[model samples]
Target: MAVPRRVVIVGAGLAGASAAGALRERGFDGEILLFGRERHRPYELPALSKEILLGNADEPAWVHDENAYADRDIRLHSATAVERVSLAGHSVLDSEGEEHRYDRLLLATGSHPRALRVPGSDLRGLHLLRTLDDSLALRTALRQAERVVVVGAGWIGCEVAAAARSHGAATTVVDPLPLPLRGSLGDEMGEVFRAVHAEQGVDWRLATAVAGFTGEDQLTGVVLTDGTEIPADMAVVGVGAAPRLGLAEQAGLILTNEVPGGGVAVDSTLRTSDPDVFAAGDIAAPDHPVHGRIRVEHWANAKDQGAHVAGNLLDAGQPYRAEPYFFTDQYELGMEYRGLADPRHDELVVRGDLGAREFIAFWLREGRVQAAMNVNWWDDGDALQALVDRHAEVDARQLRSGDLASLVP
Candidate 1:
């Protein structure tokens, strides 16, 4: 494969910005053009729910400064959305109706917050957290919100609930699930998270769906399916996120909508069906050597996959094998999880103390460690990750031995 003269990257989030930096670092002297739908330059999204919403930070975690991109010779177009992509013509059309040719194209378009289609979703005090501006706007509203209702028990919802309580709001989290984070962490670990939030004075309205919002011009209360109305002045809808794949779909790229990890389907090398075009971040569902085909929306995947695809863009011809990893912070609880495990079916074993919230929990299937999570327990990430990587069969008794090195075999 010949080196491309010009490379165009759509979406100026962490993945796109990381790819641009990796391209320059790997000695790619080609013209790099990065486009974003937001007015601000490329920044990390994790801080939006944590630091920015908590009023501990004023700015989004920028991936690179304005001058840094200029120094690297990367042309960044902020607030310029790529309206369409043409695989046959090898070009893309921006929102301004200008056509730009590219020898190689990378789609890191990321995902957007799933909307609540209830009746009063359009009310004044309803909010959805996704971008930097969304966080800032929600932060301003949270300050004066006396009663806040979060309509999801996922990471974003829990974090936003924590932020609301920090601001002295009577916060309540409502979800259809039986426990918080049950879909991801399963019931066993989800109970731990519920305890953490409950201890922080956050109320839970679980096992019930939201009927709709009640108010004329603004949100006054959240009505549950059982006809119980909880009084609230503010509401945040954070059920989950869906990958942005309109551009890729228009270009006729292969998608895996019927499969588990639905997104633009790519091969082992992160190359889409078109060959010349590639996808990464939350948009790319690549075939994994270890775990089959999967799509991860974590911050670690965006950072790692972006740089990994840069090498393949230069014809490195390597497959993506990075394990799934993510972290969450709410109140006094800080946790990191590695590997992918179906909590519903996997056998869970813990080391240390769950009551004290300082422990390492492992999810295993058929005696092999599938995933590991550490809550308020540091210094075991590398060892735990190694066990998962090796796919080593571990005895439940040995896992609680506090000696992770002995289980590597």
Candidate 2:
């Protein structure tokens, strides 16, 4: 089954598109069928929140041209919904109720924005940024949305806040955490990001909870848990995403209870409970040899996992071994983080000035560097990533010194 002659992939996000492209590059001449719910072909999602939202780019960065797919003999079904997949029957049923048999399958079905459950969430100006359409609509609304109230201060919220400010919107980002990015970068590094927002004039309502929305047909303002009302004409919720795993679960694939999406359990090579059925991207809590069982929700992980699955499906030998990597860009700040990043750390050692906006922070546990991140720095991301890879043993002094170079193994 190394060259499974017929292959079917569901969910046409970055992962699905990358898999299809990688299969061709891997020299697989098998007949491929790809399905996407969106009308447009697979595109780069990072642009949706970054370039497109800032009006720097008009169209999404498509993963492949229609002509290119046709050139590779890949039958890509855009705007076609795959209603259900049957592992027992070895077939997938489309919305039209047509069945397609496949020797192998991949569920690249990514996550969706966790919708806000407040009363006025149904209002016209309330939004969530997840897809291309969502970003486009939000960008259009930002043009006229003064006094914008952002409900979450995560990556999406921060980016949208930055974009709204660039368009002269009075932006305010709220989050329950004391520091904006505390959930990912730890408190010390999170304060750096929080200060950046404050420096840019973004009103920070940190450690505050949203009581509810206070408008009927259209969003007018946000009500805080303590009865303080923030006047607003629009709001964006970036509370993070929950994976979409209903299809895989319905197909009897085993799932991890602790993961956000009721994550589908996959082995090192990305094969799910059923060997013929595989999972990737946001929904997969893949068991990596180095990191153990973990789920990474980022563009790079999606792309890498997609490519990894294709190679594993062909040779069945290579393990999904690439270290988890992710990046974020907020206003003038840009960063790349690598290795295992657990938010529940007791301490992090910083090597540079936060006010100056150039730094490298390391999370260490018992003298072992668990993870590292670089912000607004040049050409040092790869070297920092190497330190995490080797679990380089270094004390807090070296990490906190201009001797940042010595920390690299």
Candidate 3:
């Protein structure tokens, strides 16, 4: 394939920004146009839930300084939404009605928070954390809130609850799962998070569904499915997120449905059905060699996949095989998880003390490690990743008490 003279990227999030940088780094002297719906330059999303919500930082953690793009000759259009895409003509129409053509197109459109569509969902004082503005608004409300109810016990929900509790509000987390992070960590590991939050004074309403919100204008209370009403002045809904697939759908690209999370389907090269177009970040559901067709929404996936696709855009022909990785910080506990594993079916093994909340937890199927997480046990990330990459059988006893380095071979 001949090298493209121009590249257009939609979504100015981490993925798009990373791809732009990688292209320049790889000595691609082509015109790069990056469009972002948000007004701010590209920034990381992880800190919004932790540092920003906790009132530790006000500004976003920018991926690059304001002049970085101009310095690299990358044209960035902020607060400009791409309304439509013409695959046949190889052009995109922005919200401003300006049509721009491209030799190659990338859709890193990312995802948006799934709205809570129950009764009273439109009430005031109810919020969703996604953008920098959302985090700032939620933080402001948290400071004034006396009672806070967070719906969903996932990463965002848990982080928001911790932030609210830290601000001296009465915080409660509601979820249908039996425990926090049960879907990701399984019951055995989920129990550890339950203890961590319990110690931080976070109330759990597990195994229950949200019936709806009960309030006149401002959120006054959260009504559960069991007919219990938890009084609250503010509520945050963090059920999950869905990919921004409108452009992909409009362009008639293939998309996956409910198999490995659901998003625009891409092959091993991160190339969409249309060879001239590619997808990355939260929207790209790559047919991974090891994990099958999975869509990872974590920070690591966005950062790595963006660069990976840049290489493929230059005809690298290399398959994306990076292990899925993510981290979380709630209250005083911090954890990093590497690889993917189904907690329900995989056998879990621990290398440190669970009571102390400082250990490495490994999820193994048969005798090979599928995933590994370190809770407050730092400095072993590479070793843990090696264990997962090796995919070799190991003694359970050795995994629990043996040296991590010796087990890889």
Candidate 4:
């Protein structure tokens, strides 16, 4: 057995960090170099929009401390961004024209904020919350502003709107869609979130589109297509993120498309089209045995995929399959979900109380569990997931009976 000399991982986010740690844990003693574009170390990303936005988190604790990385023998390269990967030569070029060779390379470049094309988007007060710097800028704006307008009623949009409201900012969310989160949770449960935010004092503008900006220098307000003007001290865009795949493409790596949310396609083992290079985190789009090929941007997915990549790197024979999972916190509500629940599902069964602000909605297709949402009642998350995983034809009556133990076969 030939021992590999070096392992290079790009993007020191959750995926890269986990891969490094898992490599050492799995007994890979060769040179392990972790490259991160950001000066800060890899840390958890979920808190940026929720706790960190509310001014309750210390940004320094985002990643593992230097001492911890030292103990793990994980060579940390901070403030260095990989410009390109030379797959044939097995080396990656940094921004400063430096090169680092690797026996195997992992591209975890992740995703970038998707900026809107509407005019006034370049204003100083217009911000997007994806990185620590973005979070800092948005938090400063949230504290200084009395009125805030959030465009795009998606996860980040809703979570930031809730955070702004918590900071005493008069917040209004504008979405062209009929309701928030209709793309993922469907209209049946979107109503529950609408009422939740409404009760928390967030003004909602459904089916409304932004025409342009109002201020000359900074963003003071937004002009809607309906000719309604709403005051805003700052505008935070949370539409979504675009995968950073420029490096992969430049390396002549075969790209995979046709996945939901636009991500690079990889195999079940998390290996990209180039077998020598693997991808994880928000960028790697793997074919789900059940849900087909999908690109997922979730904390749980990163961790699972990272471990899977490590196993495959050690021995190519190992099989890697990831079950996607993610959670969100908004206005005293904790919502968690697992698996792929398509947006086009025709039947949705609601278990528990939607009015009481606590319930689980199961998305089914052909009597199979496609996806599910659990709000404030995570105790039954496993049961619901089981029912979905097994493709069990759950009796609506038995599901709402408050007893899930019987449903688990």
Winning candidate number (lDDT): 1
Q: Looking at candidate 4, what is the lDDT of residue 79?
A: 91
Q: What do the candidate models score in CA lDDT, each in turn? A: 0.93, 0.85, 0.92, 0.83
Per-candidate TM-scores read 0.98, 0.96, 0.98, 0.95
Error of 2 at 192 (Å): 0.8
Off by over 4 Å in 3: 258-261
Candidate 1: which stretches are off by over 4 Å?
258-261
Q: Is candidate 1 or candidate 2 better by lDDT?
A: 1
The pairs that clash in candidate 4 are none
What's the lDDT of the predicted structure labeled candidate 2? 0.85
In candidate 1, what are the lDDT values of residues 365-395, reduced to their tens digit? 9999999999999988879989988877989
Residue-pair clashes per candidate: 0, 0, 0, 0
TM-score of 2: 0.96
Candidate RMSDs in order: 1.0, 1.6, 1.0, 1.8
Ranking by lDDT: 1, 3, 2, 4
**Alpha-carbon deviation at 101 in model 2, angstroms:** 0.6
